[model samples]
Target: MQIRDLPYADPGVADARSGPRFLLWLGRNQLGGQLKALAWGLLHFCGVAGLPLGVGRAVQAVVDRSGSALALAGALIILCGVAITLGDTMLHRTAVTNWITAAARVQQLLARKAAELGAALTRRVAAGEVVAVSTGDVEKIGWFVEALSRFAAAAITVVLVCVGLVLYVPELGVVVAVGVPVLALAVLPLLPRATRRADVQREKAGRATELASDTVAGLRVLRGIGGEELFLGRYRQASQEVRRAAVRSARMWALISAVQVLLPGLLLITVVWYGAGLAQDGRIEVGELVTVFSAVTLLMYPLRHFEEIAMAYSFSRPSAKRAARVLALRRTTEPSGVEYGRPSGDLYDPATGVLAPSGRFTAVVCGDPDAAGLLAERLGGHPAADPDGAASVLLGGVPLDELALDEARAAVLVQDKDPVLLSGTLQELLDVPSSGKVSAEDALKAAQCGDVLDALAQASVDTDGDGDGDPMRTRITERGRSLSGGQRQRLALARSLVTDPEVLVLDEPTSAVDSHTEARIAAGVKELRAGRTTVVFASSPLLLDRADRVVFVHDGDVAAVGVHRELLHGNAEYRAVVTRETEEEQLDGITAIGELAVLEEIEESA
Candidate 1:
């Protein structure tokens, strides 16, 4: 976990049972760093505890007219300084290491979960919550982790100081030994209520953050509909609620701090007051009383840690819980090692009775958009779920999920209706790992991205003359928001084309484009993917007409299958679904046209 050490080959597993248990797990994982911090903390606290003894002994020696009191005190002071300096420096080093290592570990775990679950992770958790846990929550967790050892060291110092006082001067010692523990433990009962208040505050804050994120993500749409003020008012109300919760939480914490300060002050007064009575009775020396007073005052510093540790734990517990929720997710279609799915065969969906041959274009037409999407997801091997007696899609005869994950993914790619183009340079976005076969230029051409390239080129101002007029180097804004609807869709289609999978499933890939451009894109895709398996989920006549096989889905099942023109002539249901027209209505329109033409000829003859 040190800065100089190499990266981890394995980031290790996490325990996500509960907040406290996860905290304990983090501590255990970073035990070496924790021990380093603890050792340094011990040295530092011991150094501070030794200071009063040196001062008290020097005072007593001075009172007795000793020859070398100053010399002994000077030596002890120097030794304490060295110990304190060494301990403080190393303590900082190790504590920060623990904090950073813990945070990095959590981030890695989150990244691993994200990679495993892909886009499905966000469906199961709030986007804002995921953002919070990975950023703010991780730091709070690390803060608690680093604080634990320091608090332990402080507690031990308090105990040691009290025991020394009791052994040296019993009369005043008994007072401190009893008073310090009470001061530390008195605030415990208030912690629960305070922690609850803190939790409420966190919830309110999370809601506000989520609102802000959503409002920002849809700012363009909000402005188009003139709903800025409405969203603003909603967010304002959420912000105010957070403020109220925060204030409530602060009040509880304030009460705890007041107790912490008040109780310690009372203890100090008791020690001084009682030690004076002992001096009056000649039970202890003045110098010993001075020592007793200094030691009790010193306890106040470490006692502050008690409050800090409480606050840190309160803040980090909820954070850990949120993080645990995200880390607990598992992919539904786990990869299989022993069984490999069929490499080259028709992709068959048992639910829809649709089979895409190995080297042909297939189009699916469904009246229900939602059902089409679910079927598309299933065809891509990322099904929503598997209920009892449900059949899985198979490549050849083997189940899709039975294949290794990489193999299944390599076999098929489903470009959703609304695909996302990540923020980056155009080149980086197209540089997918599995895209060695299809060149970016070729894919872009097939996707009819000529205007998209021009738009990107116009937006980019290349500093070096050598980089001029090349669209590949154009930088895209986050989520491609800077591009128009059609331009974004074209770019997404181009990006997906470059993947060069064995089977490409596109759901309405050209729905956002103009009819002319969509017609060209349909033709280009047919030419580019001539010998590969390509299934398009679309009802557009231009796209459907290009398919070698068109399967019309009715009521969540396959109703008809044929070439687009053949299906139009042969299957009335398919015609109605694709063209939004029925047989009798179409006949009536043709007869009405004939009657209008006949009346025009009669008027000409008259």
Candidate 2:
């Protein structure tokens, strides 16, 4: 593909069965660019290889005292120079183009895969791994891809130069030929060790990156809980491990590089020493001696490409494997293209036996936070395995997995308990694909986000000139760390509300807010989402009391289902889960209050 056509309309399906296969697939896709680079490289190295011959002829012309021959030799040298200049320039251009194009294709494919998998991508792959693959791995994969064509050209040029030397002076040519191959192959024994070292370094680096990502993501929480030093120490240890691995890997590669340099130097010394002897014995001409020396010197340049190609492959192999692994992951909910226009029914998970009735507000009280999260994920078709037997989570009697992915997503929106607020302006965050019935302002109001907007505006003022006081234009820090947990929650809630999906499953949406604000938010949500299917997984009395029905989930199944008050009074488990106060504690607290009141009355009477 042309450079201008970069970011292919489709990067095409990758052969991600293995790292090597994925690399080959990338090579095949960029065949046109590779061919162009190969052609230019051939021209370039061929020019470079011809230089010694031209110089040899000039030396011979001088010794023979032939002016005509000397002029011819001069012309030949100039011709070779022209080819070298032109070919080298174009070769570099094409090589860089190939590198950039390959990198772009990988990035695009990654983006597409991320979009396809959505939240499931992180669940399957570590966040740090994903980051490393997209950033560092892309460049490594591209480096090998571009190196291939150049390496091929260099190899062919070496062969041609060797053949030319052999034909010119069979004795010296044979020696040079044999020595060159030895020099090239000597580094092979060291490659496996070097590759191993590199892989270890990469693995360690990935762990460090994951640790850093996790640490940064939870820095606010860590500070709140006064666990900053603990995480910081862990990250420091990880970083040190990465550094030590890198040093070890660097030492191994340095040894390989030294071998490559030292061996080639030895070969060059042998050629010069032997050729000088041959000239002295009158077995070869003095000019031929110069030719052999110059040719060997020039050959050293292309020989470096061999070492480079090895290094590139060593680094990129693991990178390609990581990329392949990520791309190989498939979504559990495979879209079947089943045309179920605007799914309208209860969101049911047969696995958990939890159901949120259509067009009703349902509250789920799961005692286990982990179980609640899994249930929320299942509700949104983000499970590793499709809930079979009934096919998957059914919406309106139609399995969510059976529907188109986009259709399913549009119909059901699940906001996890710890919702992420991506870095963007307030307006951009709320610019979701919505039903359009609720405006951003209305969504914000319904989510009780006035304080968040004000905080954003105040932040804007602190950063910029008196800041237009427009929260919509305020720049949020990455992951919305600039805001408090409560503010981030409110903003995320507003964003979700703007979508107005048919079925909205929210897990502890108001957990971070105070009781008064939570009560108002409960009312706001009830009023705004009236007549829509909304399932909130929370045990807050204010939120639960507002639900039309409450479903108490215990041991991954619906243990009891009724209004919040009825369940709270009738089901001891449900009451304990919600209130966290046993009947004995309640009686003791009441008795203590009555005794205090009696003492106060007697004292006043006395």
Candidate number achieving the greatest TM-score relative to the actual structure? 2
> Model 2 over residues 166-279: C-alpha lDDT tens digits?
999887899899989998899899899989989998888888888888888778799999999998899899889889989998998899889888988898888888888888
Off by over 4 Å in 1: 3-8, 339-342, 385-389, 461-467, 570-573, 580-606
Q: Mark the regions of model 2 whose C-alpha exceeds 4 Å error after superposition.
A: 2-6, 224-233, 281-283, 385-391, 457-468, 586-606
lDDT of 1: 0.83
Which ten contiguous residues of candidate 2 have the minimum total lDDT? Answer: 590-599
What is the Å distance of residue 103 in model 2 from its true position? 2.3
- Determine which window of 10 residues in candidate 1 has minimal summed lDDT: 591-600
Model 1 TM-score? 0.90
Writing each residue's lDDT as its tens digit, candidate 1 over 186-261 gives 9999999999999998888878877888788789899999999999999999999999999999999999999988
lDDT of candidates 1 onward, in order? 0.83, 0.87
